[model samples]
Target: MTVASPLRFPDTASAPTMTKRGWWLVVMNILLPGSAQVLAGNRKLGRVGIVATLVLWLLAILTLLTYLIWPSTVYTLFTQTFSLLVVQILLVAYAALWVVLTLDTLRLVRLVKAAPNARAWIAAFSVVVLIGLTCTAGYASVVAGSARGALGDIFSSGPSQPPVDGHYNIMLLGGDAGPDREGLRPDSMSVVSIDAETGQAVTIGLPRDLNPVPFPTDSPLHSLYPDGYGYEDRCDVDVCQLNSIYTEVSLYKPELYPQAEKQHSDPGIESMRDALEGATGLKIQYYVLIDMQGFADLIDSLGGVDVTVSEKLPIGGDENLNGVIDWIEPGKQHLNGYYAQWYARSRHGTSDYDRMARQRQLQDAILKQVNPVNVVSKFQGIADAGTQVVKTDIPQSMLGYFVDLGMKTRKLPVKQLELVPPTIDPANPDYSQIHQLVQEALAPATPTPTSSK
Candidate 1:
């Protein structure tokens, strides 16, 4: 019998086989974490990874379904503090697990045993995948944490408020607290009345100079200014305007809004809310105060805005103290933060009504430009700027509802009624007539009856 050659099996795979194995291991790890270990390396570790991956898949499917069925609930999860914290923790944990599995898969690849030409390729591919996976998960984790911080810093932890008269009326106040100003004064005031069911909205703009603003019968300030806000015989225009309510009440009549502090609000805001409610005949549920000083930062973070400049507007320099430093010329122009701010605020040669129209136009431009892609791309900058720019009494609990309402409002045409000029004299507004106009603007269009054939 021929001397039986001592049967020998190859201890390491052949070059081509090793190359294919290396590629397959990396691919398997990506498609199904821990699968590489089960195929050749550590079975126990691979089983755990497989289980985790399965759980992850199930969770992903469940989350998608929830978002599709009840988007508000999903929004609530992302907005609430406790839920956001939980999400951040889970994201971090998932990121760590992914990193571990990717490393293990690389170890199992045994790149040294691969073909010399294929070794570099396999190693490079694995590294790129590792860095890509690690960075994506890591970035997502950071984003979740940032959102949690922003929500906690920006939104109040107050109780949810109900809509009044089938409408959720929110007061948007643009406060102009310049370096030369004495105190914070709301330069722009608008009540956004949104239909609770349809999300149809009507913006009722109140000029800052509107005098003798009325207060609701239930408001404590009503007793003090029964005739209306700044109704005294020799009332000063600067002190008696609608925007002055905030500073006036906060400084001299804090006692009028005793419950403001408890409700996460200041006396000034409550006073303004009360005055606007009385003026517009709409129950204001929430107030968002935008500091005009920080408005430029917000616009910049959104990559600037496109606005139509009807005439040349001054950028800087006081009209009395010094002439305009620069001018924003007419026609459709893309303006950065500084110019956009001036576009909405320049009052050197323009009337308050002109400024109001520009403000409204700027607002519409922002609404039109703020798509999901822009928001996601510049999320970090926007979040940072938002915290410094906005102050609101809208509670975190109700954010989900508002977000849903906002989405609906975006799809519909926004109706506006500025309390100025021929429509309603801002200098001496007729309270009853203002109420009637508001009703007409908010009323759903009645379908014309079809004529019978």
Candidate 2:
């Protein structure tokens, strides 16, 4: 037999080898854009991709470090309008760059050279990764845009106010502007005193029927109602209640609060804040007015709230007009927007005081439910509902600070004090006593000393 020359292999890779290499290039591109080009095809494009990838990595690392060291700085960056715009722009740019690099990577892979079976697998994987990454970046960009718009609509552009004393006292008013009612009237009122550093909170619930609503000495209303909000001759329950301050000022005495508009606030809201300051003895820095009718939408956006019901409550009915349409039974219950609104505002058999307590319960439950996962998933819904139903004088600049505080506040138990019967009758409230009680409730807890063994 003639000795044949040793079989010689081709210098170029076989179909199977090329297929494996193609997969490697695609994976490298996914992990680090432009890397595949540097390894195989276009060194220039690859260098640019590598540099961009490194810069993004550096930024991500720095952000992580900053969050660990000075978290508020990160919060401030995200909340600020200019910074948010920059972030949105960067996200869009990066998303585009990723797509470009991915396309270029496929060109470098030369998929046609690979085996038929391997070609399909490679193409499928590249498409999946491309779609997955781009979609994620796109979604994040949308979220940033939504947050920016919502913050602009919901919060004021006014200058940020410092914490009063060691805490921030924010007046929360739940207004009902039903078709039957004349104008927007606050049915629920409370002042939340939040510790500036620790985020501990004390909610002071004021009954809507509280008579003779006092005003600070500096307030214009002080001159009008020197002996409190009611008429001089008679303490009429109909005319003078804590909740009436809003509509009363808005409709009749708009001129009393000329500076209110300049400060990005309404005359009615300023008047209500002034009254709250006088009642609680806490300097109110901001006010949040929530439309009670639209309040259900807000609760629904949060995917519902969890609360323990003390007793059975009717959904919709008045003592005189209608019979009970629905009932929310007692025990730990998960309430949707419709039921949650009724849980807080239903007044058929329950007193205003009962409603006040329920409102506080809902508030606490909502705060607790606002965890990171829930917020991220339902952020758009929440933001949409918030803009429609909520109004506030809390400046946009301070939102980041409050966001951080809210996170801390959710972890701690809230201390509550409702100015109702037994504590102090709302019909005939003693101003001095109310002030004393507020101070006592807001006071820091005293730590007990431990004896060494």
| Strongest candidate by lDDT | 2
The parts of candidate 1 lying over 4 Å away from their true place are 1-13, 233-238, 320-322, 449-453
What is the lDDT, from 0 to 100, of the residue 197 in candidate 1?
83
Which 10 residues in a row give candidate 2 its minimum summed lDDT?
2-11
Q: How does candidate 1 score on lDDT?
A: 0.83
C-alpha lDDT of all candidate models, in order: 0.83, 0.86
Q: Candidate 2: lDDT of 274?
A: 91
Note the clash tally of each candidate.
1, 0
Candidate 1 lDDT tens digits, 6-41 = 111112557776677778888888899878777766
- TM-score list, all predictions: 0.94, 0.94
TM-score of 1: 0.94
